[model samples]
Target: MRQQIDGAVVLTAADEDVMEYLPNRGVFMAQLLGRDRGNAFGFYRGTMGPGCEISRELHTETTETIYILAGQALGIVGDREVPLGPGQMMHVETNVHHGLRNTGAGPLEFLVIGHPDF
Candidate 1:
């Protein structure tokens, strides 16, 4: 099913059902847009439980951007470790090793966008 607004697709919580868990990462993602939606990039909502982390990895051809929605996070982007909070955004270039650790007492929520489909 699809939800649209002014001819544009809108993905809401109710429109998501499939949550993909990253192996051993304690991270879950719900894809909102990608090839299936005829989009050139992938859009997703991700959640990480407190004290959880996502291991460093790189997408050879994908540029990624993540915006924090709630809680705190430590982002490992390439050779730097950056602290992130709600309303903050991080951009990672293609082939850069990047990861995230939930540093808040509560769940860490964020939106992720990857170009060329993630």
Candidate 2:
């Protein structure tokens, strides 16, 4: 048996399958769009109120890229913490310990894309 998938069949932000992950006080609205047994890809919209943040974690095989949409946040890339604002992008490699924190007056909003959908 053989199955075929058209990657351009049209996948939307809403149709990507949204899920909420509230880890260490931060909020994540994840939209999963692609998958292939061992690999997957998705986008995550994160929200963080005052003093909110995500716990540092490492990826086994997945990598991530994030785009700041609104507000400001502190992005921990490896050992250095980078300040992020609107239009800023962050790329986290696999096995790297990274996290995000809201350090602004308002809520933080950003888009995160990752592999394996994890």
Candidate 3:
């Protein structure tokens, strides 16, 4: 039997699933593309309010990339902290530790893509 496939051609941010990632940090994430939809990767948009941050973490099997859309933040890739702002991109190798903290006055918005899904 042939396998059935269900997916959308366009994913609207407004219709995506949003999750509050941290407590009292004003960090929110919206899954724009998901693995359950038969995708080879996971894509999400994260919004971090000023002073918000994601603690250091590593992905054992997935490589991740973050593209800054608006505002600025400090990105931790591996053991170093790098400044990131609008139009900047950061790549995290597999099993590397990474995180981000919003340091700008406005909300930080960015797109995150992970290989092999999350």
Q: What is the C-alpha RMSD of each candidate to the true structure, in Å?
A: 2.0, 4.8, 4.5
Instruction: Encode model 2's per-residue lDDT on 73-113: one tens digit a residue.
Output: 89998899999999999999899999888999888888888
Q: Which stretches of candidate 3 lie over 4 Å from their true place?
A: 1-8
In model 1, which runs have C-alpha deviations exceeding 4 angstroms?
4-7
Measured with C-alpha atoms, the lDDT of residue 92 in candidate 2 is 93
Q: What's the distance in Å from true for residue 26, model 1?
A: 2.4
Poorest stretch of ten by lDDT in candidate 2 = 1-10
Q: Give TM-scores for every candidate, taking all chains together and pairing residue i with residue i.
A: 0.88, 0.77, 0.87
Q: In terms of lDDT, which candidate is strongest?
A: 1
Q: For residue 45, give model 1's deviation from the true position in Å.
A: 0.5
Each candidate's number of clashing pairs is: 0, 1, 0
Compose the digit string of candidate 1's lDDT tens values, residues 26-69.
78888888877746778888999999988898999899999999
Collision pairs in model 1:
none
Global Cα lDDT for candidate 1: 0.86
